[model samples]
Target: MASTICYCLWFSYVTILHLVSSLAKSDNYIIHMDLSAMPKPFTNYHSWYLSTLSSALDNTDLDTNNLNSASSRLIYTYTNVMNGFSASLSLAELEALKSSAGYISSMPDLPIKLDTTHSPQFLGLNHRTGAWPAAKFGQDVIIGVVDTGLWPESKSFKDDGMTEIPSRWKGQCVNSIGFNSSLCNKKLIGARFFNKGYRAENPNITIVNSARDDTDGHGTHTSSTAAGSRVDGVSFFGYAPGSATGVAPRARVAMYKAVWYDHAVASDVIAAIDSAISDGVDVLSLSLGYDNVPLYEDPVALATFAAMEKGIFVSTSAGNDGPDKPLHNGTPWVTTVAAGTLDRELRGTLKLGNGVSITGLSVYLGNFSSSHFPITFMGLCNNDTELTTKAKGKIVVCENFIYSSILIQEAEAVGAVFISNDSDSSFGHMFPSIIIDSMNGDIVKAYIKKNSDSTASMSFKTTALGTKPAPSVDSYSSRGPSKTCPFVLKPDITAPGTLILAAWPEKLQVDVDNYGNVTLFNSFNIVSGTSMACPHIAGVGALLKGARPDWSPAAIRSAIMTTSDIFDNTGRFIKDVGEGYKRATPLALGAGHVNPNRALFPGLVYDAGVQDYVNLLCALNFTQKNITAITRFSSFNCSSPSLDLNYPSFIAYFHANDSSSRRVQEFQRTVTNVGVGQTTYVARVTPIKGFRVSVIPNKLVFKEKNEKLSYKLRIEDARMTRENEVAFGYLTWRDMKHVVRSPIVATTLKLES
Candidate 1:
């Protein structure tokens, strides 16, 4: 799982100089400058950037009153991810810096956003039998979370009944405000904060009072979802009141607070990755998504690549920007996770006077009756001033998700119901409110239309288990065609992310009352996004790591992907909730919903090494100079075809001259026998309707463990009947007990006029 080479054409010295000179008139720009070569590992490469900038901009002196101030003007320099520095500087300053001999090309520093977990029983990992106890519950693995911050005092981070921290752990819990060495035990092993990039972006902002304490509950939720301690009687006001345990409850966590309320800067994220890698984390879980850029250029991706090179597995969120734009977290080297539904849903039902009951999702702690009052529209209240007088003491209906709190508290409404266009019904307002989807909202609206007095009583029920037809891809979960790398399938796997009840910080506020009281709930919360999904897989990766200490990052990923299930609990193919209830494709669900039990014992895995990506760079036509810059190894050469990288998943793209030409594509794949020795597996294909697929040497025999064998898959497409067509299928190698599945996709571009 080394850096998956993102190749681009090389820019000549004159072209770079010309581009830099043209930027002299700009006021401010955020640029990522690539270095001519990677700096020495574990060294302060910031000094290299400082020296280069100082020499290039000899006419101007830096204002170095403090490191933060200096970073604000000069910007923070990154080393571990790539030997480059990101800076906020003037056009003239950038031009002067471009004169340095070490400069490569500079690109815009894209802004990123938070992409923002679940029942282990649903995935069946609670038993002592099977691979559950064999994994030792991932007690030896360390999961590093790069998110908002951590709340060390939470019960989830407690270290009761745990062994000492692993001696391989090299990280430390910095004694920041609130976060101290005492708070970091065997469970919560490390804690650190990064904000120089945030401060550089926001000049006047300061995070003074609380350091490393999760003012926002995102970090605590994700971290705990991955490897929180097993705590009994954990609940959010009696909702999900059971023994709360993470996917890997015994695994230790190292918290890296990289995101701020204002921004999750690329520079800060890269720095956190650098520290986490140096700190020797076993698995890195990042819930943030950078802007849509080439995979090689993304700072986080590059840093994660370096981490992967060190045998650390990395899992990232697929992003919540979905339904239409799902091509996020497209890097093939890291495990990109998509959010899926769970078997349990917290449902709230409204019993109407007309003998109709409607159910939706909500975490409402208490139930109340509003049958005596007539339900009326809140006059489309967008703010408190917009609340109508007639709406007082009534079950007011609001159109938007944001205005319910105002209508409930300030307007004195007896209850509030949000008529939402979105399908997700999970509500967390500090009021007796339930959001009804459009279909049910229409039913409620029609009852009001037929009767003058529309009366309804609301009651919140206990968690509903065995939710039929569950594990659907969340509507908001990003879909994927891999815009950056179309040949690669994105969102490497799916996990339970929707309405996941996990640990939450009591200090964070999701809502407030009109009386100036901040509403805070302790212990647990239900949050949805790929952010939650990522940690689930990270925890699973830790479990796999604990089970197989010698497995590479690629092997871990291959195990998860190959052993996953594409069908839901109902035995039908999983469906994407956002795709109009249509059957899910590999583009949406990746290899499919993760099967933790099966992943622990994947029989065969497609193993890839650092040089595999170097060959891909060669196929992409990257210059030898750029290759040396990224690999840091002089005299490096790419010797293999890009499509022959021995990846677990395969994609074949066919080019046609008018949809009439016969097109054939070839893909080579190799798998290592990780299961039993002296076993033979046969290749099988679930061919697409319009494609003819054949696998040469369909049967593979392995005499020893860790033995590698290769096979070639050839696909021939029939006459393309449509423009810009895509066909989905899968190729599997089956031995008797294990199904090594790989998703196969073929696409044809639209003919140009």
Candidate 2:
């Protein structure tokens, strides 16, 4: 009887707890307000927000004078990015906010994911001459890195040769439990963090303090890649051993910690960006993004637009969801970069008993016996029970790469082999392992089938440089044909993002040898992703900014895009590693792989200002109110609407089965001469089979530098026979020393009439 009574009380307590949880169902929402509509009597926007929140609660007795009273609900008050605040609101509270004055729009705070590095010599950067000396190796330029914070003690952040901090810098190193202001120096100028939105979303998470120190190696790697100091004799477990330096070694770095762990709240990211803008960073590098959303709705897009208007160049990653559509960061103002393979490879070889040698990729530093071991195939190795039974005392061959290296070790396997199509095989396994392509994997499988006993031996990792057909589009790098705005080609350029060695947190272990011992070089790590590609562009942009301080953000982007390389080091068209090694199109490579040296002196640039982007939004049917919400403009007229954005590339869309005899589209563009002296540029168009492209007046003659000229391109598609087909070509404007090229993409669609 006593036990029954106790059980009844326990049940009643759980029932009451459930009721309270249901009553307090709330979510975080970012609320945008009209700064122009604020009451005249209120001078502080925070006070106004407090009163608004109190009014929304219908609490007449609450004190609006005390700002800290609303700290539990108020997540962040954004000032620079937008006139807004993020708060934890319930369904009924959100409805009340909608009816409140000055309220414009509200969106639920979403989650964003974090998306690295290489030798400067691979991109033709020389220390004594060329871009390095011309740009002073990006001295005194500030690059704001927004990601998972950074490791302040890394050798790549040493300021031994750095000059004094730039006078324009106004940022500070926020003090927390583990990090302090004194940790910052001349090289790493500032550090800050935003976690209010994160804490609000995860109410149960215990945050010690708001510290901007990198725990995950991503932020440190990316920050170091953009503008890290030079470190001699750096390597990742004895692979790629040599001196390591970022693209721009002397550029000052500032850390804005927005992400926590593997993901970040959009509201926090916006807050970080807002602070960066006010802090006067010359360039913003964000290696994080979310799913493709409308420009007006995406907080990162809105914040980046504000940054662009402030003359800050923003470089973002083209995501890692590759060989797929609808990648993020499609905004024209931001330079979206994609991942590509470097000329370097960490190579390993597998020798089968049948006298067949297959070359593959691996970062394993372990050694195996020269004697061959019996190998058996275990499809995928996802099931522990199956692996335990079939994988004991033998080398296991799996059909795909799995993240759980512990499973293979626990199954008592001598070694493991993965057959994967991914171009990035930089993962260093805890055991002896190597990843081979599917075609070579089939050969091993056939060898096993033909012989009763299949034996194989693997070699240790070795550094190999100057691999042919490099700068190929990586298989994991996101592809384009921007879903939101296809007129502007996405993935503005490509850079080295595969098997890159960059600085890492020393406490982290990324590689292990055969004996399950951590590798020695913990200060650097090998990683790959478009996250790595974005900073390469950021570093290059800093170089350009330092060389040409008068150039606008648009001009810098135009130079990078217009002067990129369409061919590989071998003088062949760049190929897409994801598409069965086919020739990459504009949709895959944008203008092409970034040629930093060539970009330094692009003869002509297609420039666009804020008004041009506004015109683009107008062409896309954005309302005046929507424009105000995004741009913070009080009054403006959508007087001109045109799809022609004066971009560096041209894309014309057509219907696959339009019965009309002729389908013609025209685009107008203006180019400004940026070369040394007066010169004339002649236009040349590469012919496409199904389309005819003509440039009006076919030549642009500029008498002086900075002179502007206008031209119109007319493309006529006579027969659109294939459905969903794309034709690629180029339009080049050549002078004595510069070849300003633009990719011409003509895509056929099945449009509903």
Candidate 3:
């Protein structure tokens, strides 16, 4: 009964400036044991580049533009001290590699660092929000960050204050690869790896391990956010920072490092997808996506579709695709999210007192008469359109457009009074005087539009006081119903994917008080990104998993979506995809933001399981024909009419279609009574006339949590007509009446005599 919410985040960084992450000692399981009887992990050691270079390079570097490159050459091919060879490499070997390369010098340092100072953002998002009402302090959840590699021993993943990796992760990573008791127990972290294709030479290769040794840092942040147990309450990090941890705290992780590199080749992703299903992960969160070819192109999509068939809920970011040029992956099975900023009690405001005030009214050459003020910036006060003072003895009014520096200098120059501005560039800090939103400015503009006279008085008092960050949609979150795409909805829902405070590398903690600061060195730094928000969904997925281990991925996704809250904390519809624009579609926030509480008991959920998806592919001939693997349940070329997709599906209509199509497919599911509608509703399946489907317990009743219900469906029919097309729509049950649908869940058919 104890479950919590957590998330990873997405972020953009100038890699060049921040890549110099410090190096930490590697945690080598083999370091302590003797290896005298076996060969070293590598022979004639050389990274891929070095090995390739030896075969190509010949002459040493000569004078290139008379540049002194000797010193630079000695530091070539740098690897993080956290890498495999960093600590082991002797100075001689390091120097030799450095001397070998001419153009290249030291290898780029990982752009991560340690900041022990916890950020206020964490409290604002997790602790104060009550988003994780059940999450407790010190309790741990072993959430897996299944991505490319984790480089567990890297500088950023260390335990010391120098960087800020969690002690739980470090403690477990020391002796085992993943899910180990001593190292990976309690609050431990683990990883795995997987490959998509067979070895090219033999066309037969078995991927032994998919342990994460991160080539990218994405996996690191994601895992941390999903189940990072708190160091101390006030220094909280993940949403599930306590005992009744993430959806499933007692749940161990199965990190299947399956990344379909290279813009995503379908066949490859499928392998990982299949592996995850086989691994039986409770919940899967994918912070990746693609643009084209429906949600079925690359293997990731296929595998994701496959995993759903196996009941693995998948979640992903809505892509950074924005208003102008958008792209996203919005499959019904996947839950997407768009970003939204938080607006707290504190907001940025500007006020000007005696130090700043408007003297009087005057029209500049720019607006009143473009001729004299064709020049936008200079020549204001005197020659443009100076106005005489009126009543109240207040400062004079003037047109806004004076440069900020000019306004400050002008206010002082015109010792007569102070100044005010309406339209400027940045936020409140753009000018020295008081500032208001353009809407406030429009009030003045609207009055001017009506009267065109300066006699109307608009008085105001200024008292600027507080300054704090409010949550609103981030300016960079992507919008959806992707461009060049019409059917798919994107960014299913958004979470707190921004600069957040969490556990950091312990070594980095030292730098805190070194400069004399309130150093809670026990904690690490603060950060953000969609990568952070991902775990929130993942953790929720885990909670759902704890309830129904056999639920299909689609069902889980449906549970999360159907339960989503259409409103925010203030009871307002969360609008704006992110930044400052509308996405122009419902897909921008598919099912709205996740409502985990509702998800705990969604009234009804759409089902998409691996078997169902695979069967769907078989129906469409998308799956490869497996002669030996084919069973009696499987069918070959069937005669079914080509689909007329002008309807709801997103395929093109064509001739030469199978008129007689019959296949054996199944979708079995169970729904629980989650709402308080105590009335027992009658059961009814619609499209009552088309295709054929039989249900069990035709009518049933439910009362509480430990509810019970059952149903079985078998399809038998063969026809090709408009009726078939209509049936391809969704099948629903309303009170007692209902409708039948195709593409999986309807009683099937084959063109028969």
Instruction: Give the whole-model CA lDDT for all candidates, comma-separated.
Output: 0.74, 0.81, 0.37
Find the candidate with the highest lDDT and give its number: 2
What TM-score goes with each of the models?
0.78, 0.80, 0.46
lDDT of 3 by residue, 1-753 (tens): 123222211122334223321111111110111122223442322233333233222232322233222221211221111111111222223333455323133332333222121211322224433234433311232344556544343232223222233343321233334423233333334454545343332245433343443233455445555544333442222211222122333344445455523122344445555555655554566666666554345444555555555455676666654545454555545566654433211111111221111112121101111111001112233432222222122223233434333433333321111233221112212122233333333333333345433222222211111111222344455654443223223455556554443334332331221211234332333344455556667766665665555565556666665555445443455555342333212333444555555565555445533343334434444344331132213453334322111111111111123464433223344554444444354444444334554445555465664363544444434343342232321233233322111122231222211
Error of 1 at 98 (Å): 83
Tens-place lDDT digits, model 2, residues 500-618: 78888887655443444445448888888999999999999999999989999999999999889889877889999989778998877989988888888999998888889988888
Better candidate by lDDT, 1 or 3 = 1
Lowest lDDT block of 10, candidate 1: 63-72
Using lDDT as the measure, what is the rank order of every candidate, best first? 2, 1, 3
Model 3 poorest ten-residue lDDT run: 365-374
Q: What is candidate 1's lDDT per residue for 219-281, written digit by digit as tens?
A: 988999999877776665655557778888889999989888736888888899999999989
Best by TM-score: 2
Task: Point out where model 2 deviates above 4 Å.
Answer: 1-117, 353-358, 365-367, 377-390, 402-410, 438-454, 509-521, 660-662, 750-753
**TM-score: which is higher, 1 or 2?**
2
